[model samples]
Each structure stands twice: as C-alpha cells, then as structure tokens.
Target: MKRNLREKTKRNIGLDLTRIFAFLSVISVHFFLNTGFYKIPLRGKRMFILATLRTSFMVCVPLFLLLTGYLVSAKKIPLEIGNLKKYYKKIIPVLLSYGIGMTVIFAIYRLRGDRSYNLQKLVFGILGYKEYSWYVNMYIGLFLLSPFLTNIWASIGDKKTHLALIAVFSLLTVGPTVFNVNDLTSLKAIFAAYDDNKINHLLPGWWYNIYPLTYFFLGAYLRTYVDFKKLRPAKVFLALILIIFASSAYNIWRSHGGSFQIRLWNSWGSLQNTASSICVFILINTLAPERVNEKIERFLAYISKLTFAAYILSALSDKLVYSFVNANLGSVKESMPYLPIIILSSATLALAMAAGVEFLTEKILEKSVREK
Candidate 1:
C-alpha cells in the first residue's frame, strides 16, 4: 500500500510538470503573437512552425480541466456537496489575483494616455469579458458547473455513455459553424452580442471556454475507467505524434483556403496549441531521460508557482522593456536580429519581478491572518 501511494505521488508530480510546461508553451505563443514577432520577414513560415508546436501544447488547458474533474469528482454520483464548497474556496484566490492583475494593467494603459475607461468594460473584463480574460471566465463557469458535471460523471456507469455525451457536446460545439447553419445564426448572434461583439456565445460555452472543462471531464473519465498502467509508453508517444501531424496538416490546409476565421478557426482549433501540448505531454511522460525529467520537473514546478505572477508582470515588463530598448536602440526593425535576445531578457526580468511581488503578497497575507 505504501509503495502504491508513493507511485501515485510520483505520477501526480509528473502531471504537474506536464501542466507547467503547457503553461510555458502558452506564454511563448502569446509572447510571439503579441510582439508582432510573427510579422518578421519569413516569419510567416516560422509562425506556421510555431503554430504546429503550439497545437501540441494546446492540450495543456484540457489537461488542467481534466485534473479539475478528477479532483472534484472523486467519489459518489453527481458530486458531493462538500467538494463543491471546497472548490469554491480554492478558486476564489485565483479569481481575485486575476482581478487585481487586470486592474493594474488597465490603470497602466489609462495612465499612458490611452484614454479608454468604462465601468462596464472593466466589469466585463474582470468577468473574463474580452481577450485573454476569457480563460478566467471559462474557469469560473466550469467551477460553477463542476458540481452538476461531477454528478453526471458519477451516475454514468458505462464508458461508452460518457464518450457519447462528449461526442454530442463536441458536435454541438463544432457543427453550426462547420456547416454554416443559418438556423443557428440566432444562437451565434446572441453570444456575439452578450460578449459585446466578441465571440463568446458559440459552441455550448465550453468551446468558447476552450473546452477546458470538457477535456477535464474526459481526463477524469479515463482515469476512473481506464487502467493506463498496462499501456506501453511508445504507443502513447506514437499516438501523440500522429495527432500532432494530423492537426497541423488540417490547420495549414484550412488557413491556406482562407476558410479560417481567427476566433472560430485559429483560436478554437489552434493547431499549434493542440499539437505542442500533445508533444509536451508525451515527451514528459515517456521519452524524457530520468535525470533530464527530474531537472525539468523541478524547473517547471518553480515556474508553475510563479505563473500567475509572470503573467501579470509580462504586460508591465513588455512596456518597460520596449521603452528602454526603443530609447537605446531606435526602431525594432533595425534591431531585428536581436529580437530573441530582447524577448529572453524581457521575460527574465518579468519573471524576477513577478516572483518578488508574489513573495511580498504571501508575506503580507500571512501577517494579516496572524493578526486576525
């Protein structure tokens, strides 16, 4: 029993490494996309390559959702009420942190003579309204639904039944847009309006949420029903490779045909996001040499602890670093060859700053609670 427990703990650690790497992939993709690095000469091809890489990492969000389902749905049919309450407490800090970070960014933008501030926009963004905040909104929505979803998972006895449900949801997610169904126009229109002309309403809300919860449930289902211990590592690696190739080819084809819309196709399907996530998962789980994996695991764990801080600081770091670099070096185009160096430096500075802020926040919280 002790041995079994130890093995389980190791597996969990491995999983955490997977999650952290996925998050890093997300950061890298966003950094490149937002910095206009993709627009560099011959960068389109490079972007395509990165997109392929990104798709593999796209699986990361789903992996996280899967972790949520497994953790939340442990025991009983339809969920235990106690678990719901517990998760609510757990998610509060995440929401609050994201809120505080968003406010900081908003204030900075406003102070920089950007001149755009509205209560509704602020509230909406806080609620995961537009841009990257959508992930937060999706997470909040999933947390709210977890109890019911957990219940559904508990009651379903057969694997086929759960898989069938997933298929139905995926179809509901992809069908209307794929076929361009006019009847569903109202549904699309409603979401568009609700998201304030943003693409939030499409695909059962889960897809707009990047289907993280759906993937989470799927992972939990597999964990509960399947005995993956008997599976060969090579098989898993091969399967991941195949999936990456297929997803990349499909994305490239779609992109070339001009049939791709950023919100619907690129963002939703995100071939790179999906592929990179798969590759990372498989590599971490299988091909990574023992010593290498241990080092990586440690590094990823450190980064994961600082991920929220890094995200918040990235915005500020971008502004500060860009200003400094511009002041010293003139146009980015002229300094094109040093772009990678700039990104690396900026990211390092941001990570350090974020870590400092997080450490201070934790110390303050500890003191406040002690006083209370």
Candidate 2:
C-alpha cells in the first residue's frame, strides 16, 4: 500500500507540473497578444523570436484541453449524467472567477472614465462572447459531451477513424488556413451563410469554433489507443523544435508579402501552431518525470489548482498592463529590445496575484462547501 501510494504521488506530479507550465505559457501568450507585439514590424530576429514564442504558446490552451481529455479517458469516466453533474459542479469556480475578474475590469474601466459598459455587453460578457473566457463555454460543452464523444471513440476502436477525423478537421480549419493552399474565398461564403442563416444562433457563438471538439477527441484517442513506447523522446523533442522553428520562420516570411489579415492568420493560427501544439502535448505526456520531491509536488499541486484563476486574472489584467506600458515605456516598437522582458514580467506578476487570490478564495469556498 505504501508503494502504491508513492506511485500514485509520482504519477500525479507529472500532470501537476504539466498544468503549471501550461498555465504560465498561456499567461505569456495573453501578455504578448494583448500588447503591441503584433504591431511591431517584421524586420529582424526580434519579430522571428516573437513568432516562435507565439506559435509555441498557442499550444497552451490546446494542451489544457488535451490534458482534460486524457484524464477523462484515463479515469474511464462513465457515460452517465451523475458524473456530468460532478463535472458541472467543478465549473462553479470558473464562473466565480470570471465574475470577479469581469467586475474588477468593469471597475477599472469606469474609474478610467470609460463608460462603454452597458446591459447588453454585460449579458454578452457573462455568456462569454466577445471576451477571453469564450473558451470556457466551449470547454463546458466538451465536458458535458465528453462521455458521448469518448463513447464514439471507443466504438470506432481503430486508428483509421482517428486519422480520418484529424485529417478532415485539419483540412477544414488549420491546414489550408495556414498554408493558404486552397481558395477559401468560397469557404468564407459558407461560413457567412451559416452566420446570416442564423445557424450560429442554433448554439452559442463559442460552440461554433470546432477546434476544441477536435482537440477533445484527439486527446481521448491518443491516451486510450496509442502506444508511446515506440516513439523516442529525443526524436519527439527534435520534432518539437523543428516545428517551432519552421512555423515561426514561415510566418516571418509570409509577413513580408501577405496582407494584414493573411499575415495575422499565418502568424496566429497557422499549421505550424497546431503542429507545434501537438508535438509539445505529446512530448510532455511521453517524457515528463513520474515523480519529484515531496515539497516540489505539493507546490505544483497547489499552483495547478489555481490554473483557471491565473488565466482569468491574466486576461483581465493584460489590457491594463498594456496601457500602462504604452504610457510609461513609449510604444512597444520603441521598446522592441526590452519587449520580452516587459511582457514576461507582466505575465509573471499577474500569475502571482491570481495564484494568491485563488488560494485564499478556494479555501473560503471549499470551507463553505464542506459546511453545507
């Protein structure tokens, strides 16, 4: 029993460390995206460096979703409503965090003499449209639907279906968009029709982004069906580095010629981003340490619990930080040499504050839950 307990502790440490790193990666992504990183010209190695960071961090959210799918698969969560209710209850913390964050944001804007807030926008914000937490809604849907999805995954019982679905999803979404290989002008019309025909109204706007669902299925499929023993860690690491370099360099090359929208697409959601994300996700899962010092494990576990709060706080605070940086440090273009340091510092500060608040709030909330 003692040996078994140690093994469990060891196994959990990997997952905890993964979450902690992914959370910090996401904070870094938000800082760069919300700031003037994009506004800087693609002139030298600086823009290329930014591209690498962006492409790498783009995997952060997908990594979390993949982790979610892996746990669900590994645990063999039952295809039952009761299990879902337990999952649903887990989201209360997310809702509370969003509410608190948004209220703080609203207060900041009002105090800054910005009166753009209104009833309609508030409703939209609560529903997670036109905001950072839009992924939360899609996540909830994926959580509720996971049992059914994983059921389908089980029924297929083959790698062929997995490859087929991934291919199709890639074709429709990331592949062509990244490479500009296909004439997507007509595809835009299809989406435009979907929008105008009120098809979007059939579900929340957030649900329309199908990447999350694909990622959810991919996660389950990989964890349940694939054998990583054959794949060497060195090869996987090499692949990861290659994808990051190629993707970042490709985007930099595109920026010299592509239109603004085209450049943005290539930089942000290109094939490189998706491929790198997959590599990193697989790399972490396959190669992470099974155990660590007890102190380190405890620290990771605590920080991992605050992942959602860190994400929410960073999202809310990014704009304020950007504003402050612009006002104090001049335009990001002028601070190009120091941009990375500034952005990283802001993300770290936000993560620290978020973790502190989440720690205290969770204690209070869990106490209430226990009392009830």
**Candidate 2 TM-score, true structure as reference:** 0.78
Q: Please provide, for model 1 over 22-42, each residue's C-alpha lDDT reduced to its tens digit, 9 standing for 90 to 100.
A: 555445555444454344432
What is the C-alpha lDDT profile of model 2 across 1-372, one tens digit per residue? 998877765646656767877776876676566556666666665556666677677777877877777777655556678986775676677667766665555656667787887656666677764456766766778776777776666667678877786666655555434333323346564333112232212212232256666666667777767666556879989999998787766656545523112332443334665677667777776776666677887887877877776676675567767777777777545655666676577666666767766766678688988999
Top-scoring candidate (TM-score): 2
Which residue runs does candidate 2 get wrong by more than 4 Å?
9-11, 108-124, 128-131, 178-208, 226-230, 257-270, 333-336, 356-372
The 10 consecutive residues of candidate 1 with the worst lDDT sum are 191-200
Model 1 segments more than 4 A misplaced: 1-11, 37-51, 54-57, 75-83, 103-131, 174-210, 226-229, 257-263, 269-283, 286-300, 318-347, 364-372
> Looking at candidate 2, what is the lDDT of residue 13?
60
| Candidate 1: count of backbone clashes, pairs at least 3 residues apart or interchain | 20
lDDT, residue 106, model 2: 62
